[model samples]
Target: MPNSLNPLLQTHFDTALEHPNGIKKLRELILTLAMQGKLVSQDPNDQLASELLKEIQVEKARLLAEGKIKKSEALPAVKEEEKPFVIPKGWEWVRLGEVGEMQTGTTPETKDQSNYGKFIPFIGPGDIKNYKIEYNENGLSEKGLEKARLIKANSIMIVCIGGSIGKVALNDRDVSCNQQINTVTPYNSIFYHYIFYSVDSPYFQKTILQNAGGSATPIINKLKLSKIPIPLPPPAEQKRIVEKIDELMALCDELERLKKSKETKRKDLHQSIITQMLEADSQESFQKYFQFLTTHFHELYSVKENVKELRKAILQLAVMGKLVEQDPSDQPASELLKEIQAEKARLVEEGKVKKSEALQPIKEEEKPFVIPKGWEWVRLGEVLQKFGAGSTPLGGKSVYTTDGIMFLRSQNVWNDGLYLDDVARISKSIHEKMKGTKVIGNDILLNITGASIGRSTIFPLNFEEANVSQHVAILRTFTPSIVTYLHKLIISDFFQNLVFKEQVGVSREGLSMTKLSKFPLPLPPLAEQKRIVEKVDEFLALCDELEERIGKAEEKRGEILKGMVNDTYSRNCI
Candidate 1:
């Protein structure tokens, strides 16, 4: 409704103002402005878009005569009622088929891996990512290429169907694409980039999705694409808009790169400060390091991820006996180890638990950090009464029931804790058959495989007799106090990084039971362990609160930025 901007500009900017999705939305706004003939002023002397369209039609007819492409049927003129908004004086509205040739790419029925010979870039929807074509270096064999349509460099490719529909890319070299993509080649050089930008605009993208009629895999056929209208700007102004857009987009890219670089530096700084505190030789040194971090807490803890790393550092420091002052009067870890060994022996002798295989001695080179006076390094297997994998439900889907005993999968075990709310249920009969795999209160569950490998959680008291899927392993402590310390230690950065590095497998990576049982842990004095757990929990809770506040602050900042951009456009339009 604002008259200051040409109606087309006002409408484009207004729609952008309503939903500033993110940085991506900002880029789309610039493109829409460029395509709608609002980004740059047109000179009265410059040739009109109608003249350019005539030249394009002549080229297309010549190409058709040469049999380069088939002659397309005459398209219906764009109706006056279908026009969305008024364009600038030198621009005209035209159907996309009037400016370029629309054609589908080829689809191979089958691929032979052995026949893949030379390196030629094969592009699919996945390859056309973020407006750029990423070519897989390996090329298909002559037989594979037999089924594909080859596209030349500079041709515009758009994914017409599937999950990546509406994505567009400018091919940098000759390439072959899958059936999901449609390729468009401009008839002339007058506004090739401008036309590319027009079709890739958010408006056209939405239109494509809406017009794509299929239920399963919605597709925009060549016929539908031929009817899509686009605003054609004069040649001179098109160049100017393209230049301006390139400059602004470069700035956005720089901002993203700088943000990521700064985040990486902040993480490194946080790690350095944590290392200084953990490696402090004496109480005074520890006090100095701690004070330094506390003084710059605001500077270091501004981001939620930094705060999370700090929380992990806090746990690591606690288990290493560096988080709190050690008491000389408390029983030594050496004595505690003896008690744990005796308990394990007793359990094995009473036939209450099975004895584990002999664990390898901790090598001197394997010790990552120096322990305090009363602390000792011990293998994790020595402290546990039982450590073994869970059982898989029999008959798969048939054994699963809606109202029955609970079954905890590896997915349910998060680093924070166990999530029992969405657990799968199995019949009581199945639960009874796998009684050894049944989880009890205070049982520690650890994910042994897949992407979320090494995540652990303590089972809550609510689930008394729930069994676990095979992917999860149970670790029951010999002493209740050791459970807390061990859980903290396993979740610490030191152990997690070690686990990630040592994980093995070609196809799927995970922690092996043999490797897990041999992991070295710092055992502090019994009383000191209790003190460390309490301090870690207190600090972790504080981190959680800080993270929530940071999330809310980021959301508010994004909204404010969107508001500022919107206000500027609104004022310009008025």
Candidate 2:
């Protein structure tokens, strides 16, 4: 290894591994640099690669004379454009065929009983993992070996076909393998690791991809594999490069192990802290836990998963009436319910809306949790003027238009807010046809079906008019202020758990409007509802900021790793 390059390689290897994928990319960078001859310095005293090439040719000629291996057709000379990079002084470029003998394997007939049981190791792509040849789960008999190619130990094995393409491994034992693999036996012993590293390099893999041809499945045949060019260092330098790669790779493995260990520790600490907070018995203990959380928030919520947990906890606290203090001066929720009942009755009496069917009373056992003094439980149907699912347009996607009334699908509804970018639109005539499902402002939209069940948002005032599909329900309340509170309830884990229970045994069928109407809601006083919404909004906004920061930090790490790899490649190889 070059003395000047030593510190550079160490610096890259020692860089903090904030992301697992980043460390993987760094490993590739190390292999790439090694293959390009930029990983180690050249020594004038070492034998030139031109001399090494001559030795390889002599070995191949001698092997051919001995009739040990079949002579293949001469490969075309390497074109200038085919060379991915220039080598250091004394290094040379050579086709892989000149320094290796290629052999492809085949699978024995499985139906033949005589070939079933054997002691011979029969390797396949699946048996090769982490660049090591593990013991084959299936072995071939002597008769099976006759039907397959037997590759000797120390040979380089590469997957030439199928989804496992470009995976290379070095065998520690003589093995017979199936036809998907191509073994490259180096002409000289010195070229084994060098060839292995070359085939594993990103440059060589790109070449394989460019040459792979087939309509159904891309593949590289032995002939095409033989012609792939490789940058050759002197035999001594090859040894040095392989040794350096081994050292750096070992370092990378250690780094990855350490990262996983650290993450496990952080996750344990994070879970313990959250458990203490959620399981706190009284207001005093809860406040103490909250104080600890605020002081050590960054340590606990540095990861996206931890931040997501924080969001869920906030919502849980909000719905349980534990988020804000209840004021004695505020009106109780039972009184608020009476007023809503009166308004509902007045509308029914005036013939403005039909009287809703009486729902079964909430059983004491059905109540999921206890509520504060000012809160009361009520059915979802009791407080609404409008409640039901929408209808899909007659033509589905065919009837969608670029401009018209907004058509809200389940995808458009999110926990945070409605996403209108991918929301469809229908012609004005179609919107008129679907007048019953038309949504005006201040309406709460809930996804009542499929994967997004329970996700909801309040239809914005900016959206003058819109329609919903059958999967979403348009909910209008007696008061606009309560819609925000209801939206929060629908998104909270408390409601989601109950919603999931309602959907059980009804797989393709969605949540029934009847069942949704019967959903018991823990209603807080009108004044406290506003406070809960405000506090939830405040904490959720913080979670949003934390999530965004985590995302940016991860992205920044990726960019820095990419820049380091690209900058190194350009400075040394370009």
lDDT of each: 0.78, 0.84
What does candidate 1's lDDT look like per residue over 261-304, in tens digits? 87788788888888888888888998897898899887788787
lDDT tens per residue, model 2, 1-574? 2345555555655444765476787787888888777787878999999998888889889999999888988887778877767679898888888788889998889899677465688888888898888884569888888887778888899999877788999987788888889999888877699899899987788788888888778899988888899988999999999988888788788878888898788877777766776666677887887888889888877788888888888888888888888899999999998888888888889997898788888899878778889899899998899999999989889999989888989999997778878979999999999988899888999898888888888888876688999999989997786888998998988888888988745673588788888899899999999999999999999999999998888787777777765676667553
TM-score each candidate. 0.80, 0.87
Candidate 2 error regions (>4 Å): 1-5, 13-16, 38-48, 76-83, 104-148, 160-165, 174-181, 189-191, 210-221, 395-403, 427-430, 505-509
Flag clash pairs in model 1: none
Worst 10 residues of 2 by lDDT: 1-10
TM-score of 1: 0.80
Candidate 2 has a TM-score of 0.87
The global Cα lDDT (0 to 1) of model 1 is: 0.78
